[model samples]
Target: MRVHLGSDHAGLDLKNHLVAWLSEHGYEPVDHGPFVYDALDDYPVFCLRAAEGVAKARAAGGDDLGVVIGGSGNGEQMAANKVEGIRCALVWSEDTAKLAREHNDAQMVSVGGRMHSLEDMTRFVELFLAEPFSGDERHVRRIGQLDHYDRTRELPPLPESAIGLGPDA
Candidate 1:
C-alpha cells in the first residue's frame, strides 16, 4: 500500500521514523513534508497534500492511505478531513487505529507525536495498515450514508424504526 505522510516540526522526528519503518515493511511511503524543521510551518500545508494524495489515488482506483501527524494530532486530522473523499481518523490507541479502518473505512489516520512512545505509535500504524474494512451490510450502509452526505451536504433521514417510539418503550 502507498502511505502518504505529512507533518510539521512537532512531528518531524516521529514522521521520519515512520517513513523508514514503512519502507522497511514494504509499504511505499510518500512524504509531503516540511523537509526541514520550521517551528512556524503549518500542518495543513503538508497534511492537505497527504490527504489529497489518498483521494487522488482512490479516484484512480488505487487503495492508498495517509498518515498526518502533529503535536496533538487534532489540527492534522482536521486538515486531512477537509479534503473531499478523505476519511481521516484521529487514533490514540491500537483499537482506535484498527476501528478507523474496520468501521469507518478511513483512508488516513492522524497520530499525536507527543502523546505516545515510538513503539506505541508505530504499533497503532501497523494495526491500522493490517485491518480491512468490514463489508457487512450495516457497516456498508453507514459508510454509504456518510458518503452521500459528503456529496450532497444533506442529512440522512431517520429510518421508520428510529423515528417512532416502540411499544416496549
Candidate 2:
C-alpha cells in the first residue's frame, strides 16, 4: 500500500519516524512535508496534499492511504476531510483506528503527536493499515448517505420514528 504522510512542526518527528518504519514494513510512503521544521508551519498545507494524494491514487485504482499529524490532530483531520472524496478519521486508540477503516472506510488517519507515546501511535497506525472495510449493508448505506450529501448538499430524511415528533417532543 502507498501511504501518504504530512505534518506540521509539532508532528515532524513522528511523521519522519513513520516514513522509515513504513518503508521497512514494505509499504510505499510518500512524504508531503515541511522538510525542515518551521514553528509557524500550517497543518493544512501539508495535510491537504497528503489527502489529495490518497484521493487521486484511489481514483486511479491504487490502494493508497494517508496519515496526517499535528499537535492535537483535530485541525489536520478537518483539513483532510475538506478534500472531495476523502474520508479522514481522527484516531486516538486501537479501536478507533480499526473502526475508522472497518466502519467508515477511511482513507486517511489523523494522529495527535503530543497526545501519546511513539509506540502507541505506531500501533494505532498499524492497526488502521491492517484492517479492511466490513462492507456490510448498514455500513455501505451510511457511507452512501454521506457521499450523497457530499456531492449534492442534500440531507437524508429523518428516521421514521422521528418524522412526526415536534421540537419539544
Q: Each prediction's Cα lDDT score?
A: 0.94, 0.96
Residues 5-26, candidate 2: write the lDDT tens digits: 9999999999999999999999
Q: Which structure among the candidates has the greatest lDDT?
A: 2
Which regions in candidate 2 have their CA more than 4 angstroms from the true location? 166-169
Worst lDDT run of 10 residues, candidate 1, spans 160-169
Question: What does the lDDT read for residue 19 in candidate 1?
Answer: 95
The candidate that wins on TM-score is 2
Per-residue lDDT of candidate 1, residues 1-169 (tens digit): 9999999999999999999999999999999997999999999999999999999999999999999999999999999999999999999999999999999999999999999999999999999999999888888999999999999999898767877665433
**Residues forming the 10-long window of minimal summed lDDT in candidate 2:** 160-169
Question: Over all chains combined, what TM-score does candidate 1 have?
Answer: 0.94
